[model samples]
Target: MGEERNRPTIVVVDDAAEVRALVRARLRLSDKLDVVGGAANGAEAVELVRQLRPTLVLLDVSMPVMDGLEALPLILEASPGTRVVMYSGFQEQGLAHRAMALGASAFLEKSMALDDLAEDLLAVLGADAPVAPTSPLETQHPAADDLDRSILREHLERFREVFEDAAIGMATVTLAGQIVRANRTLAALFELSVDDLVGVPFADFTAASATAVRAALADILAGRRRVVKIEHEIAGPAVPLQVRTTLAPVLDSNDRPLYLFLQMEDVTAQRGAEEELRRSEDRFRLLVETVEDYAIFMLSPEGLIESWNAGAQRTKGYTADEIIGQHFRVFYPPELQESQHPEHELVMALRDGHYEEEGWRVRKDGTQFWANVVITTVRNGDGRHVGFAKVTRDVSERRAMLQEREATSAALTAANARLQQVAEDQAHFLAVTAHELRTPVGVLGGTADTLAAHWADLEEDERDELLAGMSSSAGRLRRLLADLLTASRLQSSALQLDLAAVDVGAVVDTSVATAQRTHPGAAIIADTERDLVVQGDGQRLAQIVDNLVSNALAHGVPPVVASARRIGDEIEVAVSDAGPGVQPEMSERLFERFSTGRAAGGTGLGLYIVRQLARAHGGDATYRRPEGSEPGAFVVLLPHSPPNA
Candidate 1:
């Protein structure tokens, strides 16, 4: 009980349960130190220190809930007399100084042996604790002299084992720069055995870095520097090797440098990797700078232009000196800038990683062009939004071509619709023509048959009637055949006009006589003004008049009139009747091929042929109607004969 009361009390704190257990067990070996309690982390240790008020706290630097640096002042505030010693795996001198500045009693590495660790903790508590020797050989030997020698031999052997078996290259050099001792790792770096390396000058391994290595060694020996570090290249079997070399003085008891402790680590692979990364960045920058087709640049997170490439300068008509550092909104039109669209684009890109669109963008000269643009969020390795990468391409030509294609497609569709309507109309005309031919053909066949069967037993009047029927049928066939042939010629653009000075009044009178004979009881009139002449084909002109008069007699109430008069520089020949002419909707289509226009019978080709023949003579055909119960007229207008003609 008295020994326990005299011993210094300590609380062991670590994040690892095994470390806490090991520390507590090691404190028992000191016999002059007592383990009062154990805690897993700083927060728990703080509470434990407050409760027990232990003389010393073995605290870990890193822990959950709270860390040692934070808990150090709290623990001391809780127990003013308690000393806290920081334990960590790191051996950095800056961390040690920082811990000491934070009022820590001492900073010890976790790599320290258990016996040394207990002694360190006890020293922090102001207790002079003699820790037991770890070797069984020292324990078994009771005599002081034997124990002293045994311990000295054990320490030297341990030093030798550590020196020869280190992973990095290690060597012991004389103050004069000669290699006194070298480990197998160090020998392998120079591609030689330890026996060959000893007694040789360390500078002899590298011709280029020999002077630098000697200077560093001299500095350590002269006490100007306690440690020296440098990166240098050494000759190798295949290629040159890079090494990080550190030199420190191995001091004697008088604090004078005895020899140099050398440490070298192979860093060739690390150097190669850094060089490759730099080259890759250079290549990327060159590619972006030389591109002329696309405007690739960078923008800050606030939407200000950060970088301008050559491509951006060429495409935007701005030099790098002129445009860099300007707000990216400058590329937008005034309306978009006023609406803050450029700012909104950044927000959207940040949210979704990228934003892309094709729209109008303004250039330096204020001209607008269609551009395809992409804005992508740029992030750092830590995933923080840094800026944006913008790529713009002008696509105005492509857009114009697309619009032209769409317009051409619409025209083709309309033409196709008109062709389809014409085809339907022609089919209907063929069916009507077949019906019309059948009536005439049947009439002629029956009339002939009747004459053949009844000739011997018939009266003269019956025979005369049969002969008149045959003549009418034959005239009908001749008219139908002529109209068909003329229509075919007009369709094939093969119609030839005979040009001459034609008497329009004479053509009208002749057409009227022919129409009256065909209709028999139909009332018809011919009215004319004298000296109405036109430059036209006379036969075609008469054909035009005849067809109009015949159409009026067939489809109109009687008093069908054919009239010719001079109007300005043209002659007008008109055919009109008293009947309601045609329905209002069919007025425009009156002269279309196969348009019968309310006619009860007859082929629908007369007016179509009339307009075609009229247009051939540098003239036109039109329909005229006066309002309020007035009659409609099909009028053909022909140019007046030239003065010379």
Candidate 2:
């Protein structure tokens, strides 16, 4: 009667048969408590606890028949004094707290200490003895008396169950990285089993993961590193596993570290799937951002700016802050609002696939710039419209430069046409002038030769008259030749003048004398001047005066007069004749090349040579009407170069 009264009854409840069997097998030999019955569901366990009147109930928190919480109130109603110890696979803090509030004695994890469970039961039973361990490895379990053999068998079985059926991957490795044990999970992952894996180095099975596994094992054993976790991918001919390996210290009784415990989690398919999606997004963004020609940015389907890029900032001159949340219509001129619909175009882009156009875009300052723009719909994987992707480029400078080039080309074409016309006109003029000049020169030369052939046979008086007439004709020929030579050289740009200071009065005197000789019947007057000086070639100055006087004699009717005078740093020389001054329309062109007063028997070159010679001396000549009651004057003006110059 005393033994039966002291004995305490305990009930074991779990959803798994293996877990119940492990508990019963380890606790059956206990002298303290009697495990009356075992149940696989919470309801059945609660009924068993009621029928047996057990002192303590070990109940599974998660069960198919009824959860521990759901069966708690009924179990207590049936046997109000019964103590409850909740059993669970998860140590969820909330579930444990709830169980305690519902009158459970304690919450224990499924893989928790059996020794602790034994102690908890004794305390609930109010035992006076020291706390007992529920583990069969306990010293009081009788098997402890044969510790060596008992521990050997218990440890081997414990290791086998833990490695084979723990759900999570588990393994034991020797100090040299050999695989002493492995679970079915590892075998399934690597296409190997316990027989093939045991006693083999971990690298043997993990041929692909050899490098990393070897390093991790070395660090744990020789380097004393523990609890190191690393991601690994093992590749093989028939099997591959992307896994996470966590290494831990498994020590002996003396507390020195021995075998390594490595746990693995397969993340191959999950991680690969995530990485592929991430890379696809990264590559698409890279392509859009790296486009050099198009300034791409994000926009709302409502046409508000969403984001800006480097190309957009460079092209549009607005930073992200200034443009973001702003409407696309800001890029249009205010005048366009009344007539154009850039906003409509944006709407069209959202409804359709995209909008493309070449037109003018306004700058921030309201200046218009030519631009090429594209606004396209940006969407997600489902093809639902998300927003707009806008690309803009400023092409104002390019278009403006193209227009300028076209205008330049047109100008060049017109200029070439003018040059061709001038060439044709020149050809026609040369032919006509050559024909006209030949007739007069040939007739005069014939006249001079006939007189020369009969000079000796003629009488003295007659010969003297004839010779005088011949001489005058020859002089005329010489004058014509000189005029032609000067004009030809000037036109050909081959005449190089030798410039020097000359006495202006002397040049005048020579020209007057020559004029008197050439026009023997006409009166020639030389006005008095003492000394007049100028800077010019002496011969060129003489030729200038001679040409002016000759021009006057040929065209003037009477009393041609020549004069020279000093006026400041210059000399003014004049030849006045009673002649037509100039034709009104011909005044500007009179000093031009091949210009003269006489049309018949004239190369139209005398006055042109006169003007050219004067200009070469850095002086000039012109025709002026006489001041008061005087003949029309042909005046030559000379400026003396400075003494140093």
- Choose the strongest candidate by lDDT: 1
Query: Lowest-lDDT window of 10 residues in candidate 2?
Result: 593-602
Query: Residue by residue across 572-619, what tens digits does model 2's lDDT show?
Result: 888887766666666676676544433433455677888888877777
What are the models' TM-scores? 0.49, 0.38
User: lDDT scores for all predictions?
Assistant: 0.84, 0.73
Residues 6-101 of candidate 1 have per-residue lDDT tens digits of 777889888777567656765775566889998888899889999999988988887889988899989999999998899876544656767888
Model 2, stretches more than 4 Å misplaced? 1-440, 443-445, 448-466, 491-499, 555-561, 595-601, 622-635, 641-645
Clashing pairs in 1: none
| Shift of residue 643 alpha carbon in model 1, Å | 42
What value of lDDT does candidate 2 attain over all alpha carbons? 0.73
* Top-TM-score candidate index: 1
RMSD of 1: 11.3
Model 2: clashing residue pairs?
115-134
Clashes of each: 0, 1
